[model samples]
Target chain A: MKKITLLTLSFTLSLSLILLTTGCAPDAKSHTGGAESLDSGLPSENIDATSILGAESGIAQAARPDGINPETDVDYSILSTETVYFNYDSFSIRSSERAKLEKIAKWLTDNSGKRLMVSGHTDTRGTLEYNRGLGERRALAIREYLVGLGIAQDRIFTISYGEERPADTGDNENAHSLNRRAMPGVITK
Target chain B: MRSQYDLNSMTKKLYTVLFAASLGALLSSSLFAIEVEVSGTKKIAVQISAFQGADAALAQKIVTEDLRRTLMIDPVVSQGSYSVAASVSGGSLNGKLTDTARGSEVFSRTYSGELRKMAHEFSDDILESLTQVKGFSTSRVAFISGTQGAKELYTMDIDGANIKRLTSDKSISANPSWSADGSSIAYMSYRSGYPDVYVIKLAQGIRTRVAGFPGINSGPVFSPDGQQLALTLSKDGNPEIYTISTSGGSPTRLTRTRGTETSPSWSPDGKQIIFNSDERGSNQLFTIASAGGEPIRITTPGTYSAEPCWSPDGSKIAYSTRTGGGFCVWVYDIATRVAKQVSPGLAEDPSWTCNSRHLVYSNNGSLYLLDTVTKQSARLDNGLTNCTEPAISR
Candidate 1:
């Protein structure tokens, strides 16, 4: 318990020191004085400190306009096991993947107030734009299946990563099949 | 006998002089003549003399490289149809283009800006004066750089310099499409944990969410007029093409296809849109009137074709076709209706330069500039790995 407290205290001191150094350095702020800083129009407290530090380090990063970090706002890993896979160049949910969606639907029913965010993905074999559309279809297919399972349509949101975020970054068939998927995440309404 | 021989020799010498005079006149008349065909078969030779003053070598180098990449101008040391005389002094570049054949000045201008930008401007001016076609030297390409798995929107000069990250969303961003005037870029980002279309004004650094519909909101491409964006939205059930005003408003649906439709590219005149669809079981290119109408299949079915980009000149549509288990960039002649493969292996997302004779495509995570007519290509070295979805400003 004592060690945990000490570590927490050191981490807090380091974070504050970082903020002080970044706040004092005009050059660091000036480097990000372009579009990103002007776009958010949000206060510094609401902005993600790591993203600001990323900008200070010359990696230009944009803060969310609403000042919400989705990574921390919603935990996607809660429904990780319920993720469904798709066929090659296809968004049709295979018969084998039906149980996964049923599990997710049951979880959504149990949670009641929580919504679902289904992120669709594809293998890196086709054009990015086309894959994006395909990924959307995959997510929509899952949404339709979940809706059929009695989940409300408005309670689900969908996004497509196309081939951008691949589960497996390999060039073989196994990786391609593994990459094509629709992952369900639990999000607060 | 000697008198007769002398008369014949004088006649021969007179004829030779006459022939030389006519040839010289022809050469002078053809100097800087505009070639109607953009096949890049003939290149005008321009002599770029050694620049004078500070930063002379750097200025000359950049200008020469810009001209060379066009595949329209051949830079030589001497004996060129045209010549460029340049000098840099006190943060200013003065350049003069001369028609060597007629010994007349074409244009002279003074440019002040970043050294590389000034050089590009000078090169563009030279190209315009010679061919009457605008050069793409000053144009920028907005692309998605996926370095470290944090896909972000970034823009760079056509020559791959001055890279600026327009978004640090710390999330996936893709399909960057620039406004016709190059003032703004419309792209999709998952910043809010959902796909949303946003337009970022480059000068002001302001971003406005244009489309955040219930389902997937993606593939936002600016219309030629920069007023409307034709994008893919699944709000109406399936992925379909819809046009929305740049400002937030109700979107006008263009396609009612049950299959997926995305990547809508507008015609230069803003009268037509060519996009990709899989309504026939396989993805194919289709064209439709910008106004509500039926979509006409442009590519043959059975083969996979997607990511259709209409050239700025409205003469060709460049797209990626599945060939030999990999994607290759192919250009479909609008007039001839013949599709010819312009790239070799794994080339996709072909974006045309302003000249419409060159295309910038992504292959294996690197962007490449391709001269469609000459089949010459060069990899754009932006020093960033995993860069894709290049949208060159027309």
Candidate 2:
């Protein structure tokens, strides 16, 4: 058993903390290196030390949770988060989003006590921070409408991606357009 | 309903009482002969009404109040003196100079006619009282108005007058900035597949791309000297702030932070750059050395604040903030961290005129020039998709 150094302990700790924000894990091996790469503040020796302990103890593996991964009996295909989006920097609702948001309002009302999370996103045209704020703005936009429809505001929480987590990460305008969206997902009921 | 004549009578009585008391006070008074030391640049003057039956001191007071009201709308006249010294004799200001270019010189020029010189003095004094910054009443603003689906750039008076569309190419134009000389403007246009910054010369009628990065290149802010621009570029990877020469050159990286930064606005002195960032968590205004040093967060309570425009006098910074209710334009007085919501609701991207008296912004897809002192507003245009990000040129 290798003793965990302070730097590795903190690095792995924060990696789990960030994972708490966006629970995505494509592959276990890919994330360790990425988390190691993200651990620029920590030295390579410490990262290597942590990587060995991570493989043995499986602490790093559990931190990167994946709801969409090929695991368990839950069919993640048919079940997906509610998709929503915003127009440019505006938070107002357009006529197009009425049908989708209306269904969402009904679903939340019927499924009372369900803890829903709304995440926002924006195009790469603006600043990342701006996109994140826009993402939050988009989520809040839906959250407000849902509340207006009698959904309790406390039942919904928001996190902003600010153009970071893209549904389509292509370089073109079309991809950027699709990436700017807010998709509400349920964490608990 | 009250008659119009009754209102006039009340006004006349108020004026007469002010005149009698003011005249009596001036006549009975004596000057202490205290020569007040001028601090930086005291631009104070009394607006002596050249009107008959108008007492000099009283008229000065009245004009001062009116000027203050105009200031409420314009924020151009900071502080000034209005003289009641009504050329005290023949009662005729026929030959007397009511203002600088001759009290009567400006009637043809403006309603401020005969009041120009004194107003200029008031304006200059305002410049002094505020921060002794450059007086820029003659400045202008250029902004984008969404036409059809495309956004077109338009230039107008600081008070939203004489509006003329500067670009008609039917492209999505964003982030309009004025050169120091106020002759040229640089804005981001998506005429190409990806958005790029373009500069248009007012004198030469030349429109050319300023920056064509591989990815996003936007949020351009012309340097105080009009030599360089600080903008956001994502060509290398994630978004970052880069400065390029106005003449065109490789952009120098200002921030190495992995997170993004954009909406760079220069302080009047050009000593610092206030930009929108989220390194702290959410989008808020932050100030950094123009030379690029440690970033200081300026926003505290607000969750969202963007497009910060500095006053020409450098006393206040106007930015858009999302209160718990909705978005409103907030003015942060530098001397006192007292932030005030100047506009009632739905206003953003404030631009200060040359004089820095009035600010023009977008309110619900319409361009509006807001008088800071008078609290009066005039709509510049209607029938647009949506407009925001107004930039004033000196």
Candidate 3:
């Protein structure tokens, strides 16, 4: 009876070790094809907290008409200088545009009640659906920067206009460069 | 002697006429029956006779134009293999199609409705009888129109008639996708000053916000069963593929990658979804189970491919691939695993018609239908400027 008890203990220990390793390891199936790593390397607790906050804020926004309308409802000119531009076919924050986002992040912290709506735009170079996705990634990149600087994830909303709304409608390179941008507009509660 | 020779020559002439007449009758009854051919290059020669009665000429004109647009029939004045006889009177149209070579009536029907609609019906019937394939005459296309931020959603007939504005939102709208039943359209609109997916039931004019995710609710495509929608949502961390109930509920994420995923199209069986992803570096096509699984890449890396749409027959996928400085339409055969470029110049947003052989895509601010078999394309004149992103009902 004592030998049987010892065998059960060993089996239990091995099973627990396997479970622990798998639970701690990053998802192997998700990282196939040598694709970019899924981890953002951010604190796990921080991500969980932000997700919970995001859910609560989503519910609150759903209870009311929270988004801006008519393009005249909000005075976006206040943060006009903070409109960050991106390179062609890219969403990475350039070193030149870092200062603008930092200023906007500080302004958001100072005005705690105000939320930021990052409207992402793209040039008319790619397919419309793909551009919409690209524009979205650009806006999310800006939001991530702000969130990294201590702004709450729930306070920033991102929208992609794609190539539909352009800052300059000309077909020249000058217009395209101006069109690929992420504009941070302040929305009051 | 000369009179005797003339009598013999006359007898021979009489015999020749009788023999020729008998042969003609035999050919008409047995040899000249029309059979449908699979080749797209050969079009049936159809002679449309002017109709008789009130508004008969108008009916003739409408039918003629509709038949010409099919690219399967060649309208001729005479010596046609087939002939159409139609008459419009008292809000009804009496139409008849005859096999000219066989000298037999193929079909005869009476249609009553709007003159244009009745004519379209007759034309469709003629095509179906000749080709054994359903006609696209009654099909409608929903597209986005207007310049800059003032774009709105509009629907019109395949021939560019009966233009109807579906949305008056002075805000921008993009990526209009049709439900399989053609009763509703789901599109991404910025009317709320944010990109949100909205579905408009064409009959009751009821609009519902199906997806209002916090960040980037775009590229909404209805499943084949119409019970769910596959879309790209970035509400969770990064842009990912998700499926949500058509009536609006919690979205089920289908893809997990650091790359951006968009343009999700469901297979005909509704089991698999083909979408565009940049997970492998460049935008390429990938297929994943609708329920959620690891995505298998469909296109070669290093080339940009996007806006994928599965053909109705489940045999092929039509998408736009980036060519030297411009985009071209390509159809990828699922079985053979071969991709063929079907368009010559700049083309994007390819949506397949119900026939699956033709595609309606936007190029240079206009929509064009391309015959994949023949590689021939015809511009669709919607009479609207700056039109793009065309979605045709199956």
Candidate 4:
């Protein structure tokens, strides 16, 4: 217990040091100026520093318009096992992913407030136009299967990113297999 | 607080901006004519003599580079079968092409106006008269080039000179289809964060989203009359072929299928469209009337084929088909229903010139113009990498 507390204390100090160094830089100070400095006279004693630090870092990382780092922001661990993979030049869902689609359907039923989005992707094997159509078909297939499994159709949205977004950037068969997938995400908005 | 430090920084930024602006001005005005040479062994031999008058050497050099890059003609110093004797008088250029072997004049034409325009006109006229084939010399091809996330549209002359960037959306903008009259280009862009078909007028630089249905709106091909566009949209549950008025309205669905359909190309009469559909398992070429009807599968014996383009004369349909060697350009004779391989390497998206004798396609990242008569393929190196989807405009 003592070791954990000490580690947490050091981590908090380091985070504060980083925030001060980055947030109080000359250019940042010049832009933000006196109003913010005057308002932030003292750190609140009752607040949780970790959550404050997380919120501060999130604000700092708002460079992306979506405010979510495409690489790491979304916790797709829930849908990682439910990912539907497709064959090369084909968008039909393989027979193996049907069980996972059932699980996803049940999960959607449990979490009625959450909306789902299926984004289709493809490998870099064919023409852009063909790949786009293939990607959309893959997404539609997944949506239909989910609908068949009792998921509400109106709660799900589909978008085909084509070969624009790839899970694996390699050109080999293994990478291509990983790239031809339909990813699941929650629509917060 | 207007501190002296702030004032000094502002002045420094202003000076830097001015310096960059002046440098850009200088580059645009002086170095607009890109100096590049194309060399090949199997080239037609010709001699370009020195011209006399203002900007004469520049004009001669531009003409030589232009003709040399075609990969069809070679400029020599002496002992040439054909000779191009040119001279500048006042603001116009007087040029003549003569057959040295027969000692007869092939043609003579006078080009007035800018020196660059004169050089281009002379090259076009010389090529057309000598070879009896339409010259792509002065033509321009708009293509898509950039990294994956930053793909945009760009246009360049056939000689790989005078590159002009058409779209700066900094997003994915591709599949540029030029209108018959070259007044506008219809392309698919994701600037609104969704793939939508947008038409951009070249003269006024106005972009209007012609088709933005619920789902995919791509592969926008203009009709021969430029009154309508045939594209692929997925609003009806699956990717299907649809045709919409160029002015924008409700899109009439053409192909109602459970499989994928894309890459629509119009015939010369604009009565039918040849597109790729995977309804029978593998992507293959299919033809259907523009109004809508049953789609007839055109590819037989081959399971994989895509990117079909019908010739201007409506004689052949060119597409990329995977053979034992690899994916290559194959021209299918509509009359006999026989397919013959035209391009040797991995080539796709064949767009024909107005002449119908030559077709342009992208091999890997470089664009090449293939001469159907001689079976010769020449690389059009515009110094841009990842260039694909070429559309020729008159």
Best by TM-score: 3
Better model by lDDT: candidate 2 vs candidate 4:
4
lDDT for B8 (candidate 4): 90
**Per-candidate RMSD vs. true structure?**
22.5, 20.0, 13.3, 26.3
lDDT of 2 by residue, B207-316 (tens): 87878764457778888888888887655443567788876779887665434467888898988888776444446677777887666667434556777888888987
- The candidates, ranked best first by DockQ, are 3, 1, 4, 2
- The predicted structure with the larger DockQ, 2 or 4, is 4
lDDT string, candidate 3, B50-120, tens digits: 89899888888878877887777888999889999998888899999999989999999999988888888
- Alpha-carbon lDDT, every model: 0.80, 0.59, 0.81, 0.77
| Model 3 alpha-carbon drift over 4 Å, by segment | A1-70, A106-114, A152-155, B1-38, B300-302
- TM-score of every prediction relative to native: 0.77, 0.52, 0.80, 0.77
Off by over 4 Å in 2: A1-179, A182-189, B1-137, B158-162, B373-376, B381-385
lDDT of each residue in A1-189, candidate 2, tens digit only: 999999999999999998898866434332111111121122322112211211122211111112321112122122144576556554446668667777777776777756566656787555333654345546556666666677765666544445545677677868866777777676442
Sort the candidates on TM-score, descending order: 3, 4, 1, 2
Instruction: Place model 4 in a CAPRI quality band.
Output: incorrect
**Sort order, lDDT high to low:** 3, 1, 4, 2
TM-scores for chain B, listed for all candidates: 0.85, 0.66, 0.88, 0.85
- Error (Å) of candidate 3 at residue B390 is 1.2
Top DockQ hit: 3
Candidates 1 onward: DockQ, in order: 0.07, 0.03, 0.12, 0.07
True lDDT of residue B384, candidate 3: 93
Q: Where does model 1 sit among the CAPRI classes?
A: incorrect
